[model samples]
Target: MSADGAGGVSRSPVERYTDRMVAALQRLEASDDPNLTFSRLIDVMGRSSHRLLILLFTLLNMLPGPPGFGGTIAWTTFGIALAMIFGWPIRLPALIGDRKLPLSLLIKLSERVAVAARYAARFSRPRLKWLTGAAATIPFGIFVMAISVVMTIPIPFINAIPNVGLCIMSFSMLNRDGVGLLAGLVVCLLGLTVAAAALFGAFELASTAIESIR
Candidate 1:
């Protein structure tokens, strides 16, 4: 579904992407199929698959969850990053893709993301087009892959940091906003630095504990 501008005005890229996401969510909500799997969700997203999946996974990573859930998301995102880098087809394994998602929870998450997208669309535009172009995919994929690895570390209270960057990156991609991509890159770097420091501190603490025990 296209978001046609009122009075024949053309919608911005940000607005268009946001509208696409909302429409996809609405379609999911309207579906009568009882078993809504990840594969089905991707099929519903059509050409928006890559961008929407990145957005979905990033948002899912931001949510609080039980032990090891962060690692799961991190690994999934790792695969996605590899796909982005290698130009491989994005597909989940049957084990994961076939798993059913709770429609209500999915809708709730999509609603939150949609609201954020709409708000961001006000300030986002397609500038610095070079950064969002084909040349940038390799670097972006590498950064995302690194961040995903950091997220998998059992660093308490740090899972959300990189994810915030990832969320921005996803939005920037959708909106084709290179300026936003630069901002997202900065955030990802900062998050990576913080995670590295935290990991270093953890090792230091462990070493101190071992010495004390000795």
Candidate 2:
């Protein structure tokens, strides 16, 4: 319930942050508040690894279908991704970060993520482990940042593609699966291409309309 303890006790590394994330969600279920705030969720989850926090925000933004508060969620994704890139602790702006969310959604999301993570973990291993190393993660950070940008764009159903990409990247990162990371990058690039085409089409249409009006 409280922030992660400060006992300074030694512990082994947990490669997949998803495990910690699942535990955090379960703990939140026991809270009295039906609606959970972002700050509160952090507290409940304790001082977990950065990877876990990033995964949490990214998954919430990647839910398929109509988004509950799409803009808010997208901005939160942006903030978290920026943090990852900058090597800073994740922090959302007060507006998006402090907002309260329905516990039902969080609970459902956590369950679905847990299921997906399990399946993904099976095929993931330490092969090409260098991809996850410190220098390599910078590119990964940029990849995540690009996904966040795509998610924040106000195009219909546009976010869905990148959502899949980010999910793949997230799972791979958690499992330390280098091969998965490569696969994810491919997916992410494909999604970016789609998004770019959509944007170009929209711009051309707008330009045509303006010229016609002239």
Task: Give the best candidate by lDDT.
Answer: 1
lDDT of each: 0.75, 0.67
lDDT of 1 by residue, 1-214 (tens): 1347687755666556556766776777776864577667667765235665777778878767678777877777777778878887677778666756566676787777667766787788778888877888888788778888888888787666678988898789877888898788788778878887888898999999999999
Q: Pick the TM-score winner.
A: 1
Worst 10 residues of 2 by lDDT: 8-17
Query: Which digits, one per residue and each the tens of the lDDT, describe model 2 over residues 1-214?
Result: 1123368532212223555666677776776754688767766665334456556766776554355566667666666656666777665567766878666777788777667665654466656768776676567776676677677787877677677777777666766667887887788788888989999999999999999999
In model 1, where do residues sit more than 4 Å from their true spots?
1-6
TM-score of every candidate relative to the true structure: 0.87, 0.80
lDDT for predicted candidate 2 compared with the true structure: 0.67
Per-residue lDDT, model 1, residue 21, is: 65
